[model samples]
Target: MTSDTPARRRARVFSRRRSAPSRARRRLGAAVRMIAALALAGGVYTAFTPGAFAEDNVQLSAAAQEGKALFDNSCISCHGRDGQGVEERGPSLIGVGSASVEFQVSTGRMPMTRQEAQAEQKTPQFDETQTKQLAQYIQELGGGPELPEGELVEDLKTNPDALARGGELFRINCTSCHGFGGGGGALSSGKFAPSLHDATQEQIYAAMLTGPQNMPVFGDNQLTPDEKREIITYITVQLQDDRDPGGLFNLGRYGPSTEGMAIFLVGIVLLVFTSLWIAGKS
Candidate 1:
């Protein structure tokens, strides 16, 4: 074997040095690829995050924003910041829908005095426009059934059978608490059925749809929209605006009890007159 020389050793050292750099280069390339994969994974996770999904879903309209301001001012105390409501103080406004808000606020039945069996109607805290704004806010918080725009009652002027149909519906469904004349009546508790005299078509329709207070929900499944409007026409046009036809006394329109009283009084009066006339003639 040839004796080792500085030149040969130096050549071997040079080869080793070159090979070291190549190995380092391969390690660096692997590190770079690993870092790039991590970054891509992070980006994909963020794109699919729940927070991102929520942000996309939270878009609100201008009317809803205006109503939000009003809700924050007046309704936040009981309803909470997001209208989820305060336990024992108020119920959730989210998912209650605009129809519920309109029925309660428009009819002056909300911002209640105290929790009871039912809420009573008073002068509304907000006017018509403000009430609608509040409804908009509540509607956007969590979606639910909405009132149909435009006239609540369909045109029934030409329908001769509309009044009769309405009266029949009212008697079958409404006469239990509301009297036959639409006068208010007492309920099981201190609560009472309110008079329909002052109720507008919108209020009536909203009440039926939302079932405000102790009232039961009469959804579209229970009463079709046409049937609801028919019921309203009967309440507003026929019952509220009845006339004394045939020139007979209506006797307060309380039906058989009032009629029996009137008959009894007239019979007594006639008998007394006849007896007095016979005595004088004899």
Candidate 2:
């Protein structure tokens, strides 16, 4: 074989070095492609698999289940299976929450005596625990408004502005039927929207949730829970601050009509008595 030229040998060595780098680059690209493929596979697998981060199921207690069964059997005729109520028979129990259930059941207004214009309070059919279970059963059936934990009544002192806001809300919503000063009003039927003067915060809340008798339901969608609390505060504060100057018993704050009647009857009797005293002295 003839001896190789210096230029030719140098050219061959440079080509070999360039080819080695090209081979290494190809291997590196293949490795990156494989890694990407593996990552995509992992993502697909996770998405298809069940129970990855599933929500926990709500569990009912035995009593609640039993109550639900009883409700279905006895009450569902009027109340509906879902407790949304029938059109003419019963009102929706959805979002009325536990407080209303307790009040209605404990007072024996529920499991009604008959379909009447109003349900009168009487001896309770269910005990406290049973009442609570029934309430829970209704609550779980169709989620609606619920009472907050701890005390049912919240202190209005926490937010003074709530009272002001509540008054405005009351005027807009309740004043039409309950009157401007919480004096109850007559309804279409013999039913009346009872005075708020004697109602507590919880009672007011329950009334709003339950819609009691002829009153229309104010669901959370219509009036939020916070707004309900504010309304209660406004009513309570008004009742507490209303001090009568005449030392006369105010008949549920019926305003001018009752006041005028009282003055006419009592003032006439007093005037007659004074005239009799003058004649006796002469």
Candidate 3:
């Protein structure tokens, strides 16, 4: 017959409180032990597999070595130590390839002055030789789509059949973004489809190969080498010709948009002047 004494109840409550703390301590200790074990396992795995994760010691060619130095000096802040890319700054260049580098550097679209919606074409920071070196470093880091050798548009010049094929291809694949006359157009974001009138053959080829920015990659599976060359010919030769059948001024060649704007402005001016002349005659 145990009586319900206040002291007895107090003692039981105190014991329960003590047990809870002990249980919590045990759980915390177990968690610490598990974390320590995981850390040890990771260290051991990394130590045993040196070459599997790191390429720091891999020997580089002379050009690649120079490129490395250039990258570290000018590009490391954005591109990261091994061209892995910096967070919220640049993208990983691992598989972007030399052609991409050539296009970006040659067009002066990189070594960006500031982070914007897109990199715009400007005066190049590196010369042709230096650009190649930077590209070589990226290529050696991880091989990617390479630039085609020799003249890309030469063969298409002699073949009228191929030139026609190129025009059709451009209309199908590029006109949606670049506009019918290649004057370029606005995109969803701050980015824009640049005017192809200024783009060179190499730049066009690289743009298609790497699919810079919004452009999709046109690999061999999509557009064959011969097909690529033909497209380049259509843009550089036919589109660039100063002799427009319609008139001297191309009016930006932006299809209906440019023409509409021009007509609206010119019409407004004429209407204002015509009203003024009628008032004076009256």
Candidate 4:
């Protein structure tokens, strides 16, 4: 009887040990399931948040959609499906703001006559509202530089100090292509940077916003709208205000080359005339 009892006890102990592993495995599975559920909830929360997945659904107005369709049909052949132009055709419109679109389209320089050295103003294809709609569409497609919602004209007097600030901004921003004095310069190919001498405040603002022709677009991100206006103020008020001591016929403000030519031609003509008059008198 004692031997039988000892054997039975040992067998019972073995069975209990074997069952422990099964219990542990069940617990582990439950834990894994709990962890997976928590992870799924976290992922759901992140996805629904603003700017997380919302950007994908940014809807355009009806006008913008129409404009986009028009752009895709008419402009995209050369400008590219996404407004990133092909080499030597159009430039990337990624950041070019509505102001640029408005200027180019409204002025009739867009839907270009042909690929040329520069696009000159002609009869516009779209009316004012359509132009604005196109601008809005482009603005929405790729979030970039935008014209301020309210009035475009800013209070020039409030930031009178910005003129000096603008001077610095101009030197850094405008001087490269427009030159230090806003005289403008030549670009690659036959394209030339148009002189700012004749540009009005709105025109300059529009140009900075639009980046017409071979000029690369400078978005508000690249140069803020306020900074743009300040630049316009500096160029128009300060630079344009300062008059040349020399009379009309500023000779393109190109300095010595033009002056030298004028001196040689005019001086030679005067000398020859003076000599002829003296000989006639004798």
Per-residue C-alpha lDDT of model 4 across residues 190-224, encoded as one tens digit per residue: 77776677665655777776667766667768987
TM-score of each: 0.70, 0.58, 0.74, 0.58
Alpha-carbon lDDT, every model: 0.80, 0.75, 0.86, 0.73
Tens digits of per-residue lDDT for model 3, 91-116: 77877889999999999998999988
Number of the top TM-score candidate:
3
Clashing pairs in 3: none
lDDT of model number 2:
0.75
Which regions of candidate 3 are displaced past 4 Å?
A: 1-54, 243-246, 255-282
> Cα lDDT for residue 210, model 1?
83
**How would you encode candidate 2's per-residue C-alpha lDDT over 1-282 as one tens digit per residue?**
978999999999999999999999999999999999999999999888643331235466787687787678778888875676788888777666676787678667788869776776667788777887888877765555555665543676457798789989999999889987787788876677776776656667877877767777788898888888888877877554563322356755645567778889999999999999999999
lDDT of 1 by residue, 1-282 (tens): 898999999999999999999999999999999999999999999876532221324667888888888888888898887787799999777677899999898888888878888888999998888888899877877766688899766587447688778779888888787778777688887888887878888888888888876678889998888888889998888766663312256655555566778889999999999999999999
lDDT for 165 (candidate 4): 79
Predict model 1's lDDT versus the native.
0.80
Best of the candidates, lDDT: 3
Sort by lDDT, best first: 3, 1, 2, 4
Residue ranges of candidate 2 with Cα displaced over 4 Å: 1-59, 69-100, 157-160, 180-183, 197-200, 220-222, 240-247, 255-257, 272-282
